[model samples]
Target: MPGAHGGSQLPLFSLTIMESVLDAIHARYAPVDARVAEILENIRRDCRALERESRNQGNERQVEEFIDRLRAEFGERVVIERQRLSAWAVRTTRWNYLFTVRGDSTDRIVLVAHYDTWRGPGADDNTTGEEIVKQYLLADLRAARRPALTHTYFLAGSEECGLVGLSSQLLLALGLQAANLALTQQNWLWAVVAAALAPLAGYRFGVSGSREYVKTLSTEQLRRIRGVVSVDSVGEGRLYIPRGTLGADFLHALIPFGDYDSINDLLEEAAHLHGIKYNNYLAGGTTDHVSFLEVNNGLWVRGREAARRVAARLARRPYTPPLRVPATALVAMLPGKASPLVFGGKIHTPRDTPDRVYPGPLRETLLILDYFFHRLDGGARVGEPRNLDEFHYARLYRTAAGHLLALKDAVEPNRRNVNGVYRATATVEGKRGIATVRDLVGWGVETRLRDQVAEICAQLGLTWERERIDELEVIGDDARLHFARHLTPFQRLAKASHRAIAAVQSVVRNWIFLTFFALAWVLAQVFGWALDVAFSLSTPFALWVAEHTVLTLIAVVAVEIAILLYMMARRIPTWIDNAYRHENRADNLGSLRRVRDQTLR
Candidate 1:
């Protein structure tokens, strides 16, 4: 009822295209084409089955039943793969069920949802999610023309048990697949989709599953995931968008958490039309995206003692700081109500039955996802996503752009702005170096920039920081850059030593002449003592003694001056050598930083 009247007011051209696609999906076809009734019926049947399934008994009969139902419903289109779990799953196994519908291209949009329940008949917990996947699969199959991207429906098991099904079963397989494809196809992009439980008054977003799934992937595997959509608890009191750490490079959308899909759609349209935009958003909560950041960015904090021990081993420094995951890789979709309550009052309880679930919210979620997929498949344009009227997109874009440009100035000397990001490159005496800098929060336009910046820094031998450098308003935008400085501890030490050496050299070089004068003065006094010891003078012979003392003093002073000059001369070369060594280290560091910056830019 909420989204029904809230039509997506897209641009006229896109709206026309969207309507055309929607019409086609609703059109009747031979051998029973896709219909809204089918979706509603499937939802009801799944909810009934879920209510009856005995998942808590641990016999795993429900898993088999669900698998059988899928096979019977889709025939050969259903493919089940057994996934062995780690110790984390507590010996529970996972079965990844996939239903694929080929399209005009090999690029896939994997829509996934879990089937495990906590304690009771989990209807709104996930029955809605299962039904949605079924609807999409059927619609894809019945379509006369193939869509732009391939559609894969993955119903994962063991999700209720610490995300073992999603992490080990689905993400691992996808990563392996992407790795294999990398040898031949470098541009392969895939998206994983999932929905969190809904129906609680305040609870309408659950993204932990999707977040953890992406975290388990290696970098190569992560590169293949271009997008991720999480459909958390929906059909609640107020529709809003999700906001937090989402693991994907592009096209991250979440439905009904706070209704982030609408925001995602608007950003995409704007990005596609205009160039990229940049800004900062909170990496506030946990979701499947957090896992992606973990795998890619190594974002975890060790215990203080453990970190101390590690730092001691590495550099005698013992502060194991919490590692901050770069926000660049998280193209998050934060859409849903602002309320934090994701599960309705009955979730995981005995009362979480079919009666608790409502068709109104379910239908609204179904339409949103339906229109989204069709849009991805080049569908008829409808209206824009909900809640765009409140925010100022143009101002945000302008501020972000200005902030991006200002990063070059802020990082100064070795860094320069390039392609809407900052790059540091330089070369000294044939040795090259490089690094890149981008927005730390990675809101838009520069989603992948920060991660890429990390990669270049690693390649160019620059020290990388795990957190943002600083947070200050830049050009009226909360522009933050990934904190990276080209100096390591060794380099910093070398720089200090170089300064000390230079100071010592200046003093020694000036003191060389002063040393001769001081030695002559000392020799004059020594000659006077010699004169007193060699000649005992009476009252009449005092003048003679004085004359002899003067002559002896001059001779001794000349000899002492010569000797001191020789000694100081011998030591000057060694002092010069030490100075040169320290200077070389300092110069090399500066050169390396410059070279790195130059190469990257």
Candidate 2:
């Protein structure tokens, strides 16, 4: 097994696949998840409904109707928060909406998309994403029997005029966590006139359209979070991102891309009907994912990875911490395209409507939705899901590779030589199809090669970083680690007893703290209040006493070091005999055992 519990090897409750189930909820996919289509129609209907309300024909009637309809459909899941903006067409202009579906989890992941537009339906700019998310949410909600998470949101608004409501929503979300305080208080602090600019400065940068978005997402947090996946400005066309080659042998993708099995997975499918290429775009900025990198430094460490280990330790019926280290390992950007089928066969425009949005991306979106469900059902651990020795453990080791790659890229921007690896300038080969030191070791395997690897490591002075002759399997868990298996039964018993004794000794640790506290109190009283009372005036006397004491202590340490070095230099026989008084080490313990054995003989 790669990355699973050893018990049955196959995880309990098998992975959950809720894609079709969700599609059914929205009535989108035909014959099964027809709800998908239904969900799309609803998006268009909602947009038109909002437009009608804005037209002043219905006035407040339309606004109230819209909210009531949403509450009726979504039930208690949707919550509303009101705000007043200084600049508005009318007083107390309600400018925003945040829809949500909670799950049964402690941590929250925010996935935001806007739905508002200045005019013409504003479909492709966001209508596409809005529909996709709505369908996804409807599908997720249909299966209410499954667990639900809280505090996550689906935010939609018209970004054409300005970010407006979205900014406040984000600030509230991040502020609560960043300042280790309530979201309301943190916002008040951030919005206050006297608060320094530095604490929440990350909002000013990101891939978003805002100039001062820090009130929303902080740059420091973005840098510190585990990972981010973005989807933006996609329609009929294939998804594309430009990632230069890491090495000649490495693939075009610098890291894992989406939930697809392979590039060919995207190249073929119902999407094939539309003829899209989900290829790398190389260098272009359309959506807001760049903001994640632009602000919030970069959450390089893994969050999912840590959570997985923790959840595994809990193992449900009653939760418990795992015996392993945990951290986040993967972050991604998921930018979706607009509907291939919409009004007038266009997207991201008022003309972009439910009639023309394609089914392909929707299907893909459903599949991703299924991935989230499956991850939750089986416990969302980092890396490929499998048994103990299989994928999971391998990822634990590969997680280190992320940090290494980051370091390598930073140090070798020109793809020059890495720390110990041969660079473009240093690599040499006299013939084509020839192997150099760069080739994979096991394939060109030999004892001599391993010896050479060790030799090269020693030469480079990075044996630890490069490789060691010792098999890593020795450190592998699910078996023995650190200690050898060859010890006799008696030795094992004795060693176990020794460890038990040490564990028992640990119970009295508080005694050390109590002793230190008692001594400190005694010194404070003797040299503090009593002396002050005796002197009747303390300032000059206390200062003078400390100076002499501090200087004398430093002088005593200097004298001791000097005397020790002098004895060593002269090779003098000092009276001191340095020996470790241990029962298990090579000296007294061995002697005692030998003596006992001889006496028995």
Candidate 3:
């Protein structure tokens, strides 16, 4: 390598000294390709062996054996914790292994890999991740100098089954039950009910393991964490640096997680510097990194407080304030050769064997990670706290408001025609007459249009501030007008009727008094006879109803089921239309843009 600094070549003697230093640095953590291959093979073999043992005994035996192996390899530095998780009436125990490497500074870099496999040998799915972490640890152990940042390797179990291990641990550590965390103090009764149902809710939500270990950490220790990198499925194919979990925009809006952009930027820089080919992806499914990001951000506390305020207002109860936590948390991941949008390859299949994974890509991935860790440990900036509310506002403004504007423009000619007709039909003969009524109706329609626009914006998570409504008025008219343009004249009239109906429904849906009135009407028409029958014990009809109790119960159940089906039929079409629109918007917005082959000189 040339010894140059800022375009100035060094003296021959200085060049020689620089070469020696560079050679020493390279030697410190250089991984032999053959050795890496051998380690991966051994891991696959061990997994297969334990899997056989599992068949003889139970699946827990395989998990235990894997834990024992970690203890043997990492020795005293390894700490293991057991977690109990229940899902769908089946209870299982999973373990999380932590391998701590002390360094000069308390600031730490956490690396995670899930060792649990799905249906198969799981060689490419996660054996590669385990090998990568193990190699990094071995390299650190062998280096002459202590690392600048402490490194913690978190080996998570049971990631395949809906993040059970990850979510359970995080919830436990945060002193939260899955359901009650979303309830407020004003909702004490509801909170109690939620708590009682937490276990079943937790299981359905796939809550289960690493957070238990996180809970054990002191506040100082937690704050010292610099970044978390989850290594997964890197045995073959192209390397990918995942930014976040895909299709989690809704969950993220409610409970903000720390941004991973900084970590992603660093990964790209490191890969380019090391001449590694890679892609930036939003992972289709989540990994262990999600747990770390969610725990560190602490925005769930703020979200719960907002929920509490709303609950208090609704119930006319005293509000309880929420504690604030800083949202500067960073998390990133390196997934093995896989599709970002769909599950591709032989992952979770019996065909995901050792031979399927290539050593060349594995070694390359390790090198890229090595460079990434070095840069990160050198005090590179890792995270930027995001304003999630602002992000949602911008997105809504762009997608919903932009569409509304486009639709408004598309119907501009029609609006002009209608205005022209109103102006032309005005007669000054006797009295205002037809023109006066038309003008009044037109004014009402215009007012309703603006209000509807504001209401739609509010429903989409934007504040109904006057300035924002004014901005929308400037940009476009009501969204219904835009959508109505695509319909035939009769269809457009029908749409107008539908809008009127919807407006009335919205009033009844939103106002507590109106909702109660509607409920009372439904009870009077549908359930009053049943209640009357129960009350009139002395009547012949009541005696007949008591005689055929099972038949009456079945009839009531059938009616309820029929009502549910009708409601679903009315909603499903609208849901599908919205889904298509969202997909189209995503495609137009370039959410899946890729940066490829941009290596630095």
Candidate 4:
């Protein structure tokens, strides 16, 4: 079970022997699903046919021929479209081909690959990926019945030139989705992006292209997405699943690498004359699936909050708003291998000739994808799939209470430290890790701890920046530790709710204070005028305090501080009471029966 869901409790290993054992198991195994074997055979035939047509010809002509052949083979399942790109007034167009198989479910799994090469015949770089994706598409089309999940093939052009074609295609999709206002509906089950899956010798797993694509998606689009699987460079007779988040970087971390057991199961079952060899490791690089991991996790939630705030203001309702809850979790499945060092080195060079390509890797790659498709159709979630405990609750009572205690200890009764300073330097360690708050007071300690956690997230490559902790911010999502089994999504949601409520209260309270000050000033002016007429008094100072800008600013500051102090004095007891109550509830919620009993009571 260590590798069942695509992770292991044992440390990552790169030993050749381990790779050999796994490969041997795969080669001897027989597929449990008859359809998987049938589809693999179809993939083999298509790959062979495609290989025979390879030549160091024009890129456009090659792409066109490939598209034509696919359309002819798959019939109505195939659709081809062209998109234009412009830079500095220079324009260029690339073709995008799609093959769709509709199913009973609205959830769709999209497979992507590029058809163009950087130079030469680009056999290993993408030809293999293209054919593999096409084969899967054709197999699904030829099936006697529809699978439970929809499968879409997206064959993009100009990928070798800098992913231009894929970029255009994604933007076009988003534009269409926005125009149709389909953000609320579930659309993507996951996306599998393939490139360089036929490399010889040692293979590297890369998902940089996928990451780029994910980075472009809006938060709403991201929410519907479950995961991204990258099928790249499978030719080395070995299967590898890099740490999902790091993609290629997992190789560089000197950590052991392993494959998803489900994928491995299919590979083992489908192996023919060739054996699959692979070792998961740590290294960093980019691939198309990286886009899946880079999706904006909380943008939609924030937009909804903004909308609620506007509605609340119009309705004159209390500003307390619901917390953000993302529709999907961050899960990326990176299948093993890109071109081995030897094969990849020739990719962009003229040496990338037809002779460098082979059929063995292509065949193995197809089998792996075939099994993956079957599993998806059977309803298995990949890459950090959540369970009931994760969805319903979190063990954050200790963490939260500890944080509160730290805040309480950071301040003296007078709100200053022994050094007569309101701020202190402190640190706290938790289930996640250690965090340091430098030069912080009671309230500042809370802020500093949050900031430090965010900083740690950046160092671990969990966030785009060091300050923003989006919905997917968690240790378990890390490509290395995806098997940790517990996540704190609910705890984060609760914190976000509390933060939002506090922010609204602050704004409304400030507005109220300013309104009262303005009213008092107006009344003072009227009284001053009445006194001026009733008694001959030199009240220039009183008038100047109202008229002079500096005097007015000083008066406002004094009033604001007084208001803030009064509010804090009034709220401190309430805050303490709530904190204790929540801590008690958290402790009680840890046990399922206790939670139910408490509810009943």
RMSD of each: 28.2, 24.9, 18.5, 23.7
Q: Rank by TM-score, descending?
A: 3, 1, 4, 2
TM per prediction: 0.40, 0.36, 0.46, 0.37
Q: What residue pairs clash in candidate 3, if any at all?
A: 164-208, 165-208, 165-209, 168-207, 168-208, 169-209, 169-211, 170-211, 233-336, 234-336
Candidate of highest TM-score: 3
Q: Residue 345 in model 3: shift from native, Å?
A: 4.0
Q: Which stretches of candidate 2 lie over 4 Å from their true place?
A: 1-35, 47-66, 73-78, 82-94, 146-151, 161-235, 240-277, 282-285, 288-295, 298-355, 376-601
* lDDT for residue 368 in candidate 3, whole number 0-100: 52
Q: List where candidate 1 sits over 4 angstroms from the true fold.
A: 1-44, 50-53, 56-79, 90-93, 161-221, 246-295, 300-344, 378-601
Q: Regarding lDDT, does 1 or 4 come out ahead?
A: 1
| Model 3 Cα lDDT, one tens digit per residue, 1-601 | 2111101111212211233432333455653556665767766675677465442133356557756776676676544556443233121235566667888897888887766666567777777787677667767766677689888777665556534433653554344433344454555665665565445323322213444455567767767887777787766655556533321222342222434555665565444333445433333344666665555344456467778889999999999653211111111222222322223446666667777666655655655566567666783321211111101111112232222211111011111100000111212222111111111111111112334344455556543322122111111111111011123577546545555554554333223223333544474467757658565755776777789989977887677655643333333322322331332232222211111112222
For candidate 2, write residues 1-601 as lDDT tens digits. Answer: 2111101111121222233433433232233235445645655676576565552222234335656776788787655532222243121123334444555653333344444443345444455555555554555556545344443333322233334333533554464344433344655654443233223333321123321222354444332322222333332332332221111000111121122122112122212212222333222122323323323122232345456657877876444422211111111112222322322333334564444444444434443434443433333322211111111100001111210100011111111111112211111122111111222111101112223234334454433232211111211124221111234677667656654543432321213223323444454455455656744676776677567877855664465545543442222211111111111222111111110101111
What range of 10 consecutive residues in model 2 has the weakest lDDT sum? 403-412
lDDT of 1 by residue, 1-601 (tens): 3233221222222311244444454342311213334544655565565455455333245556756776777676544544433343332224444566766766556666655556565555555566666666666666677668767665544445333333433444455445545544654342211111111112212333444344454555444433444443332322222222422211121210121333354334332221122112322233332333343132122235456677688896555443332222112112222212333345555555555455444444454455456565666443321111111111011121222211211121111111122322211122211122233321222122343344444454554432222112112122212222357798778778786886675454334334445555576678677657656655445666566877755766677756654444334533532443454344334321111111111
In terms of lDDT, model 1 sits at 0.40
List candidate 4 stretches off by more than 4 Å: 1-60, 69-75, 78-82, 85-93, 161-222, 244-276, 282-284, 297-345, 358-360, 379-601
Candidate 2's C-alpha lDDT?
0.32
